[model samples]
Target: MEIPQIPINEKERLEALQRLEILDTPAEKAYDDITLIAAEISKMPIVLINLIDKNRQWAKAAFGINFCESDRKHSICAHVINNPNEITEYKNITEVKEFDKNPLLEKLNPKINYYCGIPIVNKENLALGTLCVIDHKPNQLSDAQKTSLQALAQQVMLLFELRKKNSSLTKAKEELHKQNELLKNFAGTVSHDMKMPLSNMILTIDLLKAQYDKQLDFQGKKHLDYIKQASFTLSDYISSILTHYETDKIADKNNVEEIDVNHLLEEVIDLFHIQEECEINFIEENPVIKVNKIALEQIFINLIGNSLKYNDKNKIIISLNFSKDQHYYYFSVTDNGVGIPEDKKDSIFDLFSIATSVDRNGRKGNGIGLSTVKKLVEGLGGKITVESREGQETSFKFSIQKYSQKKTA
Candidate 1:
C-alpha cells in the first residue's frame, strides 16, 4: 500500500495540531455526539473524529469502533488532510490499487469496502484531522450526506479552536496571578526596609531643633521643618504602597462579621482624632451589616480624613448617611471640603493622583489615600463614586454587598 504524501504546510499543520493539546485525551460527550450524528446521517456503521498526529491517526471520538489509533501510513484521514478543500471518497477500497492491500482493510471484521472523509481544517487553512465514515459494502454517499458530513467536520474544527482559546486564557490568568504575588512581596520588603531610615532622619531633625532652639536662624529652622515634612510624606507614600499590595491578602485572611455601623463609625472617628470643632452627624440610624471589618475601617478612615484635610470652613460639616436594597448597602459621606474639578474627577481614584497640590490646611499630601480606599471598596465587591461642585462641597458614595450566610461560607 502507498503512503499518503505530506501537505506542503506540514510543519505548520503539525504545530497547530500540537498546540490544540487534544491528542490522546479522554473521550468527551460533545465530540462523541457529533460522531454519532455523522454516522446516522451517512447511514454508516462506523464513524470517527480523528486527529492526524506526526506518526499516527488518533481517534478523538469513534462510533461503532473499539480501536483508538492506527498508523498514519494506513489512515485514510491522513491522506484527506493533504487535499483539505475536497472530501476523499472510495466507493470500493478493493478497486483502489493504493489502498486495496492496506493492512487496516485486510484486518477489518466486516471487510472494509467504502470510505468517505471530510478534512477538519482550521481558520488558517491548516488541516488537522478528519470526520470520516466507513461501510462494510461498496457504496456512494448522496449529495446531502456529503454536505452534512462536511458541516460536521466544521463543527469539529470549531471545538478544537474553542478549547485552545480557553486554555490560553487560563494560562494568562495564572501568569498574572503569579506576577501580582511577586509585586506584593517586593513592595512589602522595600517598605519595611525604608521605614527605619525615615524614622531616624525625622528623629535627628527633631533633636537638632530642640538642642539649638535659640542659636538656629529662622530660615535654618524653616528648611529643617521642610525636610521633616518631606521625609514624613515619603514615609506615608511607602506605607501606602504596602497597603495597596497587601489589601487582597488581608481580605482573604479576614472573616466577614456583622458590624454595628454606629460603633464602627465611632471607632473610625476616634482613630482620626476628629477635631472637636468639626460638626459630625449621622443623618440616620446606621444598620448592622456583615462585612470585612478591616476593609470597612480603611475605607472610612481615608474618606473622613480627606474630608477633614480638604475643608476650608471654620466649622467643617460632615454628614454620613446609609440606605439599602436587597443586594447591597449604600453609604454616603458628604463634606463641605474643596470639591474636585470636573476634569480631575475621572482620574481621582487612580494611583498617586492629586487633584490639588495643597489641601485646605496648606499641607501637601502623597495622593494615595483615595486610591487605596477605591481598591479596598472593590475588593469587597462594591463600587465607589463621587459628586462634587468645584470649591463648594464633595460627597462620596459607595455600595457593598449585603451580608448573606452563603457569602460567609
Candidate 2:
C-alpha cells in the first residue's frame, strides 16, 4: 500500500496536534459518551474519536473497538484530514481500489467494507484527526446522520480545545503562585534589611537638629527635616508592603480566640496615643467573639488609625458598633474626619492608590492601609465597603463570617 502523503503544512499540523496534548491519554468518559451516541445515531457498530499523531492513529475513545492504536500508514483518518474541511466516505472500502492494499484491511476481524470520517478541525483551521464510523456491510449514512456525525466531530475538537485551555489555566495558576512566593520573599527582605537603617537615619536627623539647633541655619534645618520625613515615608512604605504580604498567612484558626471587644478597643485606642480632645467608643452588649482576633485587630487598627490621622477636626469623634446575624458579625467604624472624596472612593482600597490627602501631621499617605484592611476583611470570608461625605464623616462598614463551632454536648 502507498503511504498517505503528508499535507504541505505538515509541520504546522503536527505542531497543532502536539499542542493539544491528548495523544496516548487514557479513554475519558466524555469522549466515550460521544462515540457511543454517534454509534447509536448513525447505526454504525464502531465509532472512534481518533487523534492523528506523527506515527500512529491513537483512539482516545472507541465505542466498539479493542485495539488502542494503529500505524499512521494504515489510517483512513489521514485521508480525511488531507482535505481538512470535508467529510470523506467510502461506501464499500473493498470496491474502492484506493484503500484495497492498506494493511488495516487484513487486520479487521469482520472485514470492514464501509467507512466515513469527518475532519475534526480546530479554530486555527487545522484538522487534528477524525471522528469515524466503521461497518462491515456496505452502508450509507442518511443526510441527517451525516450532519450529526460532523457535529460530533466538532464536539471532539471542542473537547480538545477545552483540555488545552484548562491546561493553560493550570499553568497560569502555578506561575501566579510562584510570583506571589517571590513577592513575599522580596517584601520580607526589604522589611528586615531597610527598616533599621531608616530608623537610624530618622534618629540621626533628630539628633543633628537637637544638638546643632543654635548653629544650624534655616536651610540646614529644613534639609534635616526633609531627610527625616523621607526616611519616615520609606519606612512606612516598607512596613505596609510587609503587612500586605503577610495578610494571606493571618486568616487561620491559630489566632481565633474568645476576644473581649471592650478590651480590644481600649488597646486600639491606646495605640494612637491621641493627646487631643478625641473620642473613640465601642459599646457592644455581647462583647466577646470567637474569631481570628489578631486579624480583626489589624482591621480595627487600620480604620481607627486612618480616622485619627486624616482628621482636620479639633475633636476627632470615632464611633464603633457591632451586630451579629446567623452567619456573620457586622461592624461599622464611623469617624468625623476629613472624609474621602467622591471621586477617590472607588479606588481607595487599591494598593498604592492615594486620594492625595495629607494627614493631620501633613504627611501624605502610603496608601497601603486600606488595601490591607480590605484583604484582612475578605480573608475572613466577608466584604467591606466605604461611605463618606467629603467634609462631614467617613464610615467603614465590614462583615466577617462567624467562625465554625463544634456542637456541644
Candidate 3:
C-alpha cells in the first residue's frame, strides 16, 4: 500500500487539528446524527466522520463500524485531505491499482468494493479529514447524493469550529473569574492595612487638639482642622473602594422578600443626617416590592444621597415616586439639583466618574457611589437610567422585575 504524502502545510494543519481538541473524544450525538443522515441519504451501510491526526485517522463518529481509529498509511481519508476540495470515489476498490494493496480493502469482511469520501475542509482550506461512505458491492452515488454528502462534510467542519469557539469562551470565563477573585482579595487587604494607619492618625490629631486648645493660635488650629478633614476624605475614598469590590462578589440569588418602599426609604434617610434645608418628600403612595432587600437599600442610598450631595438649590427639593407595569416596578428619584450635563449622563454610572455640581456645602464628589448603585441594581436583574435637562431637574429612574414567589421557589 502506498502511504499518502503529507500536504506542504502539514505542520500548520496538524496544529489546527490539535487546537480543535477533538481527537479521541467520546462519540457525540451532534456528529453521530450527521453521519446517520449521510448514511441514509447515500444508501451506504458504513459511514464515518473521520479526523486526520499526525499519524492516524480517528473516527469522531462512526456508523456500522466497531473500530474507532486506523493508521494513516491505510486510511483513504489521508488521501482525501491531500485534494480536500474534491470528492474521491472508487466504484470498485479492487479495480484500482494504487489501492490494490490497501490494508482496509483487504480486511473487509463483506469484501467491500465501493468507497466515497468528501473532505471536511475548514475555512482555512485545510482538510481535517472526511465524511466517508463505503459499500460491500460496486455502487455509484447520484449527483444529488454527492451534493448532499459534500454539504454534510461542511456541517462536520462547522461542528469542529463551534467546539473550538465554545472551548475558548469557557477558558476566558474561568480566567476572568480568577482575576476577579484576586482583585477582591487585594482590595480587602489594602483597605484593612490603610484603615489602621488612618485610625491612628485621627486619634493623634484629636489628642493634640484637645491638649493644645487654649494654647494654639488661629493658624495652628486651622492647619490641624485641615489635616483632620483630609484624613476623613481619604477614609471615605478607601471605604468606597472596599464597597465597590464587595459589590462585585454579590452573586445572583433567589433571596426575594416583600419590602415596604416607604419604610426602606425612611431607614435610608435616617442613615444620612439630612440637611435641615433639604426638603425631601415621598410623593405618591409607595408600593410594597418583592425584591432582594439589600440591593433595594443600596439603590435608594446612592440615589437619595446624590440628590442631596449635588444640589445647588437653597432648599433641595427631592421627590421620590413609584409606578409599575406588568413585569417591572419603576422607581424615580427626581431632584431639583444642578442637573447632569447631557454629555456626562451616559458615563455618570461608570466607576470613578466625578460628574458633580457644587452642593450647599461646596463639596466635590469622589464618584464611586453611583457606580456601586448601578452594580447592585444589575445584580438584582434590574436596569437604571437617567433623565435630565442641564441646570434644571435631573431624574434617575430604574426598574426591577417584580419577584414571582412561585417562579423563584
Candidate 4:
C-alpha cells in the first residue's frame, strides 16, 4: 500500500500548525460541534478534526471514535492536507484500480468504503488539518452534503485563527501589567528621594524668616515667601506624581467598606479649609454604600476642591445630591465657579489637560487631580462627567455601582 506523501512545504506547514497552539489539546465543544454537523450532513458514523503533525494525524475533535491519533502512514486525512486547496473523496474507491490495494480499505473491521475531508487552511494559506467523515458502509455524497461539509471545514479554520488572536491579546495584556508595576516602583522611589530635600528647604525658609525677622527688608521677606511657596508647590507636584502611579492599586477589593456617604463627603470637605464665604448644600439621601471608601473619598475631594478653587461668586455656592437605585448610586456636584470653556470640557478629565489654566487663587494647576479622580472612580465601577456654562456654574455628574462588579468569588 502507498503511504501519504508529505507536502513540498512540509517544514513551513508544520510551523504554521504549531503556531495555532491547538494540536494535542483536549476536546473543545466548538470543534466537536463542527464534526457532528459534518457527520450528520454526510450520513456518516465517524467524523474528526484531524490535524496533520510531523509524524501523526492527531484528532482535535472526534465525534464517533475514542482513539486520538495514528501514524502518518495509516492516515487518509494526511493525504487530504497535501493538496491544501480541495476536498478529497473516496466513494467505494476500493473497487477502483488506484485504491484497490489501499490499506484504508482494511482500516476498519467492516472495511472502510467511503471517506471525505476538506482542508483547514491558515492566514499564510497553509493547510493545517481536515474536517473529515468516514463510513464503513458504501455511501455517495450529494452536492448539498459536499457544500455543507466544506462550510464546516471553513468554520474550523476560523476557530483556529480566533484562538491564535485571543492568545496574542492575553500575552500583550500580561506584558503591559508587568511594565506598569516596574514604572510604579520607579516613581515611588524617585518621589520619596525628591520630597526629602524639598521638605528641608521649606523648613529652612520658615526658620530664616523667624530668626531674622527684625533685620530683613520688605524685598528680603518677599523673596523668602516666594522661595517657601515654590518649595511647597514642588513638593505637592512630587506627591501628586506618586499618587497618580499608585492610584491603580488604591481601589483594592479589600479596601471596600460600608460608609455613610454624607459623612464621607464631610470628611473630604475637611480636607479643604474653605475660608471663603461658601454655602455647601447636599440633599443627603444618607445612602450608606459598600464600596472602596478611600476611592470614593478621593473622587469627592477633587470635585469639591475644584469647585472651591475655581469659583468667582462672592458666596461660593456649591450643591451636592445623592440617590441610588437597585444597582447603582447617582450623584451630582454643582458649583458657582469660573466654569470650564466649551472647547475644553470634553478633554477636561484627561491627564495634564486643563480648562481655565489657573484657579481663582491664581495658582496654575498641575492637571493631575481630575485625571487621578477619574481613574479612582472607574476602579470602583463608576463613571464621571461634567457640564458647565462659562461665568455661571459647572456641574459634575457621576454614578457608582452598589457592589463591585469584578468580584469573582
For each candidate, the alpha-carbon lDDT, in order, equals 0.88, 0.88, 0.86, 0.85
Predicted candidate 1 versus true structure: per-residue lDDT over 1-409, tens digit per residue: 8899989999999999999999888989999999999989999999999889999989999999897999999988888999989999999888999886899878978788899999999989999999999998999999999999999999999998898899899999999999988887888998999999999999999999999989999999999999999999899889888888777765542468878998998998898776547988874775887888888888888899899888878889899999889988888999988899899999999988998888866888777888888888888778999999988899999988765655653
Model 1 scores what on Cα lDDT? 0.88
lDDT tens digits, residue span 232-290, model 3 = 98998899888788774552447778889899999999998875588778856867878
RMSD of 2: 2.9
- Which pairs of residues collide in candidate 4? none
Sliding window of 10 residues with minimal summed lDDT for model 3? 247-256
Tens digit per residue, CA lDDT, model 2, 1-409: 6678888888899999998888878778999999999999989999988888889888889888786889999888887889988889999888887687788888789788899999999888888889999998999989999998888899899899898899999999999999989988988996989988988889888899999999999999999988888988898789888888889888664468998987888888888788879887777575688889889988998999888888889998999999999999999999998889999999999998887568888888888999999999989999999999998999999999898867898
Backbone clash numbers for all candidates listed: 0, 0, 0, 0
Which runs in model 4 stand beyond 4 Å of their true positions?
A: 8-12, 93-111, 212-220, 252-260, 284-292, 403-409
For each candidate, what TM-score against the reference?
0.89, 0.89, 0.92, 0.87
lDDT of 4 by residue, 1-409 (tens): 5688889989999998888899878778898888888878988998988899999889899988776888788788888888878888988656645455655456656677778888988867788989888888767888899889888888999999898899899999999999988888898999999998999999999899999999999999999999999898889888888878878788675677898888888888888987989899966567777888877887788799899998888899999998888888888999999999989988999988888877887888888888988887787677999989999999999887777557687
Clashing pairs in 2: none
Candidate 1 least-lDDT 10 residues: 246-255
Window of ten residues with lowest summed lDDT in model 2: 279-288
Worst 10 residues of 4 by lDDT: 96-105
